[model samples]
Target: AQTVTQSQPEMSVQEAETVTLSCTYDTSESDYYLFWYKQPPSRQMILVIRQEAYKQQNATENRFSVNFQKAAKSFSLKISDSQLGDAAMYFCAYRGFYGGSQGNLIFGKGTKLSVKP
Candidate 1:
């Protein structure tokens, strides 16, 4: 069984500042993918970043980056220079590259991030 957990239900970050959202997962499989997804009030699930389990380097996209600790089963997202547009519900997710549930994504409850100016 694989599961993702977001310890924080909500987070706040001041404009132009940085914020980190914590996520941890339990997975017995070694070949998998970890992702951070953002869903705004508009209800769109945007892919913030992704990391392959076999990769040693953390994944990054623009203002978003991840601190991936494979051995610890921890994957955290760091948002730099926060903006109002960054306010949204962020979800930590996982998917096995090969397995019965390979086509499905297991997601966390989500962390609502509020950006304050």
Candidate 2:
């Protein structure tokens, strides 16, 4: 079974500062997908970014990127130029490319982010 673990329960970053959330996974499959989703108070899951297993280059959005270490089985999200809008519950998820039964994004418990003014 593939599992993801997020050690930090919560984190806070000052406005305009950067924060890196830690994540690690245990998966046997060499090719898979990793994702970071954000959920605000409304509880809507939003994709922050994703990295395909074959890609050595980490994925980066406007203000988000990931540090993916395939050998170590670790993937972490880094948020830059943080804003109050970035404050939310961040989830690290793993997806098995072709799981016959279900297509699910297995999620870590999550790390709540707070942006302080």
Candidate 3:
């Protein structure tokens, strides 16, 4: 069984600053994918970034990057140069590369982010 955990229920950041959102997971499988998804008030799950378990380098997408600690099972998201549009509910998810339900994503409870001017 796999589970994702987002300890912070909510976080706030200034419009031009940077913020890091914490996330951790427990899993027995060796091959999998870790993702950070953002859902704005509209409730659409958008993939922010993803990291493969076997990849040593963390995944990055423009201003969005991940700090993937494989040995400790920690995957945190870093939002650089935060903007008002980045305010949303962020979820950390996991999907095994091989399993009975390979494509099913196990999601965290989510951390709501608010941007302050």
Residue-pair clashes per candidate, as listed?
0, 0, 0
**lDDT (C-alpha, whole model) for all candidates:** 0.95, 0.94, 0.95
Clash pairs of candidate 2? Answer: none
Model 1 spans > 4 angstroms off: none
- Candidate 3 on 56-100: residue-level lDDT in tens? 999999999999999999999999999999999999999998867
TM values, all candidates: 0.97, 0.96, 0.97
Question: Considering TM-score, where higher is better, how would the candidates rank from best to worst?
Answer: 1, 3, 2
Q: Tens digits of per-residue lDDT for model 2 on 12-100? A: 99999999999999988889999999999998999999999899999999999999999999999999999999999999999988877
lDDT of 1 at 22: 97
Question: What is the lDDT, from 0 to 100, of the residue 45 in candidate 1?
Answer: 99
| Candidate 1 residue pairs in clash (backbone atoms < 3 Å) | none
Which portions of model 3 miss their true places by more than 4 Å? none
Error of 3 at 117 (Å): 1.0
The clash tally of candidate 2 reads: 0
For model 2, the superposed segments whose C-alpha errors exceed 4 Å read none
